[model samples]
Target chain A: MITRVDHIGIACRDLAASIAFYERTYGFSVFHQEVNEQQGVKEAMLRINGTDDGGSTYLQLLEPLHAESPIAKFLERNGEGVHHVAFGTADVVAETEAITGTGVRALYEQPRHGTFGSSINFLHPKDCQGILTELVQSPVHE
Target chain B: MITRVDHIGIACRDLAASIAFYERTYGFSVFHQEVNEQQGVKEAMLRINGTDDGGSTYLQLLEPLHAESPIAKFLERNGEGVHHVAFGTADVVAETEAITGTGVRALYEQPRHGTFGSSINFLHPKDCQGILTELVQSPVHE
Candidate 1:
């Protein structure tokens, strides 16, 4: 069900600063950016390399937009680091159901909108060790 | 200097159980397994798709072998989660020096032997926004 690693989500206090560091150190440039009010995060997506086959992974820099945001709480506790690892899939609903049926609890009842027009959902971290896992179904399958 | 994310190191309490979960759920199979006496942990490396280009990423599951091991302390404090993110590079010595030039301290003075004969070194999490970053120069550059 999991096709490839979509992006590694990183929670930071300053989005621009983290972006600057990555760009400066590794020559990675931002490819997309958006604000998700539901998730309460200002996020920037940077592709490591522009590959058409969807083979290249991404670094997702996230900044909390408000104090009550979940990411804000994560930053307060963990400071700034990798927040989650997202896996890419071709079919979100089938993939999500397959994992959840195996006694793994799904974080949401329905799929939600994600970056790059992908459908996304979270798998409970308790089942997957302590790593928060996100399943994303890309709209454009490369 | 980084080319791509090689793998995400996950420190877990039970290597076999964690390996089973990943293999069963995501179809991730173990590509290599070994016990590193230096790190004091039994580790397993799983290739996401068994690709040869090194574009595909990996998951390194680690289980502490001794009470004094660093992974033991990490598991005790943070539970089973990401320990570090390893980035692939062409030159470990040059990449290590470049990152440290920005006042980001290297965790070790010398590169250490890593899985797949890669030369590896770490950047202090304190300097890298709470993320322990590993610079890995794979011997068989794909």
Candidate 2:
């Protein structure tokens, strides 16, 4: 089942500039950064000021690396803004079933590789009232 | 300075329907609800799965009550989606000064009344790269 908001994703053409802005203005520091080849974006996760046990609601900024990627399409149409929201889940399989049972389809047949090596699935924005939602099964560090 | 992500504001046409969707799917519960004539919207703040001490990143679902309000105009143009994001701060006045010094503009000359009766101000979407951003000094609740 869905638990907490993991991170809110923002799409930007210039990820470095966006990072500088958050750091300078909001004091958000980059705790994690990764480039997912499959997702076609460079990702940066900003650490917010709650959750002491490595669990916190953070901001994920995505800079499209390819023209045909989903985030690229989003930026082409909407410029730059919130791209999607990710929620934490313990069992993604059960969560996938639960979400699809409500007639909202996941973008993947199953969870795909996501940031921090987590398995994730995206719920179409059209079904979620224009807010693209994602469910993520936290990565096991082993 | 900004601390945590207070909540992500979503513009929806039906507050009840959006609330139901969140409750049924994510198990989020409404922690606060209010109608602010000044903002011309009915707002619902849903508590997420973390933080027991009244500190958690929540979702603020907004339904426009009047046709001429800023949110109504947003819905009329962008359809339904994430409208803005609120960053938490200890002092609204100080934070506002810091943000404005960066060449960004706030929607209000001074922080105005907001959800949960908090002092709040919005940074123009153009300045924030298409994301309408808000700074909120959470209520003391005394």
Candidate 3:
């Protein structure tokens, strides 16, 4: 069901500052950047190493666009830190159905738009041992 | 400095249960399991996607060996969830020196023995935007 460990999302107070820290400290370069009003997050995807393998992973830095955004609320409760771990999937709908069939809940009834035109749905953290998990089906997969 | 996102350390209450959950829910299988007394953790590394790429990622499920273990203390305070994010490096010593040179503190003055003969060191979370970061030099790299 899962293809790879897609990305780890990190919530930050400032997008540019966090980006600078990762780039300077770990030599990561931002591969893509976008703002999603629906999610209320300004995000940057940093490629970990220069690999372009089918399973290339990333560190996603997220800053809230508003106080009402989920990322903002997460920062308020947990401070700046990891927000979620996303797994790459070839078919998120099937994967969601298969997992939720086992009684675990999905955050959405249908897959939602994610970064880089990916389709994503989240698994409830309570059921995932306190770790919020996202299943992402990239545009290539679709 | 860093080669890849090596693994995400998830602090779990029970090693077997967590292993079963990941294997059953996400089709992940345990690739390696070890007990590290120095780290006070019984850990299982589940290979994500079975890619075997140079940058193959993993979900590291960690269970505390004793009540005084750092993982146990983390569970008592934060419950079961991600404990740290490890980045792969060819030379942990050089990576530690470079990162700490920027004023970020490494948890150990020297690299310590890690799972599977990897040398590892941790960075202070306070300086990493509240994310506990680990630098791992795998035996292959060493």
Candidate 4:
């Protein structure tokens, strides 16, 4: 159901600083940046390497827009660090249905809009051995 | 200096069970399995996708071999979840020196043996935004 590691989500106290750190330290550059009000995060996607095949992975730096944002809550509890691991899928809805059919719970009843116009949903961390897992389906160009 | 995400290291209480979970749920197959005495863990590398161009990413499941193992310590505090993010590099020694020249501390003075005959070293988590970061250099065939 899953393709590759889509991206690694990191909860950052300061998005700009985190982006700068990765850029200066590792020579990674931001590929995309946007604010997702629904997810309550201002995020920047840093290309890990120079691959434009659309299969390259990214480091997603997320900064909460408000105190009540999920990223804020994660930062409050865990401090600034890796938040979730995302798996790439061709069809997130189908993958969610297949996994949930096996007794794993999906966080959303329907697919939700995600970064880069993707569809995304989370699996319950309890069912995923305490790791927050996200399935991401890239936006269709048609 | 990093080329790509080498792998995501996950600390698991039961290596077999974790490996089974990925295989059954995601159709990911184990590419390699080994007991690294120096690292004090039994680990299995699961290929995240079918791409084998030496750039394919992996999910590394690690279970501690003994109580004193670092994986055991991480499991004690964080439970079964992601442990660290590893970046692939061409020369771990040179990368370490370059990174440390900027005042970031390395966990070791020299590159140490890693899984699959790779040389590896770690950057102090405090310097890495609370995320344990590893640099891995693939062995060269001469």
Best by TM-score: 3
- How would you encode candidate 4's per-residue C-alpha lDDT over B1-142 as one tens digit per residue? 7878878999999999998888777778899999999999999999774222356578999999999999999999989988999988888999999888877889999898888899999999899888999999877411
lDDT agreement with native, every candidate? 0.84, 0.84, 0.89, 0.87
- Candidate 4: tens digits of C-alpha lDDT, residues A15-131: 999988888777789999999999999999997742223566789999999999999999999998889999888889999999998778999999999988999999998998788
Quality class of the docking in candidate 2, CAPRI style: medium
lDDT at position A20, candidate 4: 87
Candidate 2, residues B1-142, lDDT tens digits: the string is: 6667788999999999999988877668899999999999999999774442345677999999989977899999999999998888878888889889988898899889988778999998898867899988877421
In order of lDDT, best first, we have 3, 4, 1, 2
Prediction 1 global C-alpha lDDT: 0.84
| DockQ of prediction 2 | 0.57
Q: Taking the tens digit of each residue's C-alpha lDDT, what string does model 2 give over A16-105?
A: 999998887677899999999899999899967554334567799999989988899999898999999888787787898888898888
How well is each residue in B22-57 modelled by candidate 1, as lDDT tens digits?
988887889889988887989999976423345447
Off by over 4 Å in 4: A50-54, A140-142, B50-53, B140-142
In model 1, which runs have C-alpha deviations exceeding 4 angstroms? A49-53, B50-55
Angstrom error of the Cα, residue A91, model 4: value is 0.8
> How far out, in Å, is residue A10 in model 1?
0.7
Model number with the top DockQ: 3
lDDT of 3 by residue, A1-142 (tens): 7877889999999999999998878878899999988789999999774333365678999999999999999999999999999988788999999999887899999999999999999999999999999999888534
On lDDT, the stronger of 3 and 4 is 3
Checking candidate 2 for backbone clashes, the offending pairs are none
TM-score of predicted structure 2: 0.94
Candidate 3 CAPRI-style tier: medium
